[model samples]
Target: MADYRLHTIFYILTSLLSLAVLHWTVHKVLLSISRSKFKKANNCQPIPKYPNKDPIFGYDYWHALNKAAESRTLLSWLREQYRLYGNTYYARLQTANVISTCDPENLKAMHSTKFKDFAIDSRRKFAFLPLLGAHSVLLANGAAWEHKRAMLKPSFSRSQYTNLPLFERHVGHLIEAVRVENTKKGQVDLAEFFLCLTVDITSELMYGTSIELLTNGNKDLVRDMTQSAEGGHARWLLVFLANIIGNSTFSKSVSKVRNFMKRFVDEAISYRQHSESRSISAKPTARNFEGQQGTEPLDVKGRVIYLQQLSLGTRDRKAILDELTTILFAGRDTTAALLTNLFFVLAHRSDIYDKLRAEISVLDGERPTFEQLKGFNYLQSCLNEALRLYPVIPINTRMAVVDTTLPVGGGPKGQSPIFVSAGTNIAFHVTALHRRKDLWGEDAEDFLPERWEKIQGQGAWMYQPFGGGPRNCPGQHLSLAEAAYTVLRIVQEFSMITGRDSEPWTELIALTCTNANGAKVTLTEA
Candidate 1:
């Protein structure tokens, strides 16, 4: 009797599931038919799609998934598609169709010209809410996003020169840590070390208090940040479970991070309030920019701390937390990825490395001041080239909020404007775009920094590693400055940077692009 009952229950469950699936299939077929008829009636051509050999699941998702899994990255597969399908192409991801483009005009139209017709993919933004917070500037829409951008603008303005000293202090810590590693373990995992460096720097800047992650072993938060960003099938499953039950391992972990962030912000706010209440004497002089050896008084005329800046911007604690986390997440991973790629390239090419060292040598063993760092055009070029090759955020996606037409790349001929449906998801392939020979030269795939010298500021739309338009990253100046300074300081302190991996490092897309394996390198003392 018990066995018969169990079998009956299983049969009923399976029948219901099968019916649900059939219903979904019928709905999808009807929707497709309607869309096809609509396009035909309007004389509109559809975007070209990669040949789907196995259409059982509605697309060749398994083939793309298998190939991407084998490569350990979706970027390699996307690049291959670009090679075969020209600048614009489409592929189905699960139930949704994703159109990808590397054409600069199309990219410009989507990002800037017709920005009103599209918005950040709501699904992607929702998935990130627990990590980035509900009020995050990166996730906000319309007026809220514009307001956040405007508020944060003054804080990151060019006049914020005092940040150079803060950068120097952190780089000093990074160099010290590297030196310790040089002695203790012949090679250091620079990937992890740079992450620690950025974490310490970002933490200190965000809250006016340093966690000193480089010196200490408390890297749980950093590890969690990376894990959250590198979430896979297991994480998604946990997320689904959490959503259903209101609690799961993923939710707990997210809560841990959120609580940690809230605590830090609360403490910082408390400290600022206490400091404001007390009568404080003015400090002596501006701290030396070289070593950051002295303490300068806060609330100085021309000086601003990020926390104070946020306080000025908004009184909402959640908003402050959102912006801080967003900035920290952005500032840390992207810069570290750039540094990792830069050193990885420098390790192999002695000629380029030599030229870079020569350029930095012009500073004559002295720490380059903010003004001095700017004049190293070659250093900037090298950074630019590295960004071109390995953009930290290789792929970005947007959803068409309203029906729109792309500038070009559509129809059988592939030169006409493509009609995008209201709900279509579009991806701007930065990696492929950067490598296009027509936009760049024939040596677009090559790592020649000299190319930047010729085309500097010429093709803004084409060369958008940091992205472009209203929603572009505002932290570029700070990121570039820190990277340049770190490179200069590393070269000054070390004679050579050689690593175990002789060939190009495989990319791992985490919070940003990172080495699939950690970047292991030995530093020879200068």
Candidate 2:
């Protein structure tokens, strides 16, 4: 209803604006008729000419009233810009509401040094806070964000990750599930399987319990919640409408899911606290095999897992769930999207796929074994290129807290900083930047994993799928490593068929990148 109201209001406004345009246009045309003999051929470029304006809409996403659409996609437009303007040009679709940049220095400053110069938009915060609840690090910033990050950092630390038996078991079950699906249907939904694998892994690692997502694949609860997140984000108009409606039944349902997760987290925290305070000082704990290279969970059965008593320190139940959700969501969705795309790319280009398979074969004994993934330069490069071509998050937005100036160059001499006023929403069109013609050359749109082979020492700003600086995704390195390992294993276990020549379309759901239909493919045993 609220969405309908907003649409009605927008339609009315657009109608009025159109009428006004018609009125002015009639007068202008009359004036032009009178001045045709006097006016020069190219005196003015166009009326309402916005100097230094950005492409408001090329990848037209009318699907979203106020937000960008997923289908038209931002990356495609970025390439179009290079075709016309060398590297930069002003594009206007709507009024002056959004400012976009593929400028490297602009990105570095915004994503890194001057990050706090902007804030997450209040509208977005209101929507997510209800969905994620409070104290979640994802919604937290400043000191709060720091504390939460520090607390969760240890879990992914080198020592804690020594639980390789756990890793092996999770991967084994994942492969097993795929095997079963393959037997049944001659194909498998890789995205769903990846989510299950990540969810199950997060359950064991974080809570020391099996959500049993992998074993039974019956737990549709998490799946449902994820769909909510995805579906909710798909329509910005609805989200805005919900916010406008405030306490409607739909709003309450959103709150109900948030509360449900809250309850689960609360119970876990309480149980953990009770266990810790018990101090059973039980039988002598097993030896500490943590420092050993490539140590799996089987090596430390009775080890004193001091932190087993998961007491919430200073932080509350809500924070834990937030971190838990953030990691789980981040781990599962991004990896699946990247891997799915990798398969599509490889299926088209056999040479690249074969080269990567050989690379993975050599890593038969070296897949993220403690630290091998970080050192797997070829695999790392391939993953980087994939991310560059198609970032999991095509675009990330920031709201300027104050009036700011963005540097512009290679234009008319004496052109200075482009001024953006406070409250102006700035979108870092990452997908556009990724395949930018000036920075990446002509083959920017093409998938060339070799593009990242020598990017480390060069102007790294051109390659920013994970973004750059402090707010740069902390999970990036981990995500990349996990992706390389998983894709390597998938290729090793199964050869993929990209459904003949029928291309899969991508749609942005919420902020996540998902297959418009499904990443459908036929797989045969490797």
Q: Using lDDT as the measure, which candidate wins?
A: 1
**Predicted structure 1, TM vs. truth:** 0.82
What is the TM-score (0 to 1) of candidate 2? 0.73
lDDT of 2 at 26: 100
Poorly placed runs, candidate 2 (over 4 Å): 1-97, 160-164, 235-239, 242-264, 275-311, 314-316, 363-372, 409-415, 457-459, 495-501
RMSD of each: 8.5, 11.8
Clash count of each predicted structure = 0, 3
Task: Please provide the root mean square deviation of candidate 1 (C-alpha atoms, Å).
Answer: 8.5
lDDT of 1 by residue, 8-27 (tens): 99999999999999999999
Which residue segments of model 1 deviate by more than 4 Å?
1-44, 53-59, 232-253, 271-298, 312-316
- Candidate 2, residues 115-223, lDDT tens digits: the string is 7776665545555665565765566666666555554554554443455566667777888887887789876666677767666666565556656678886654555
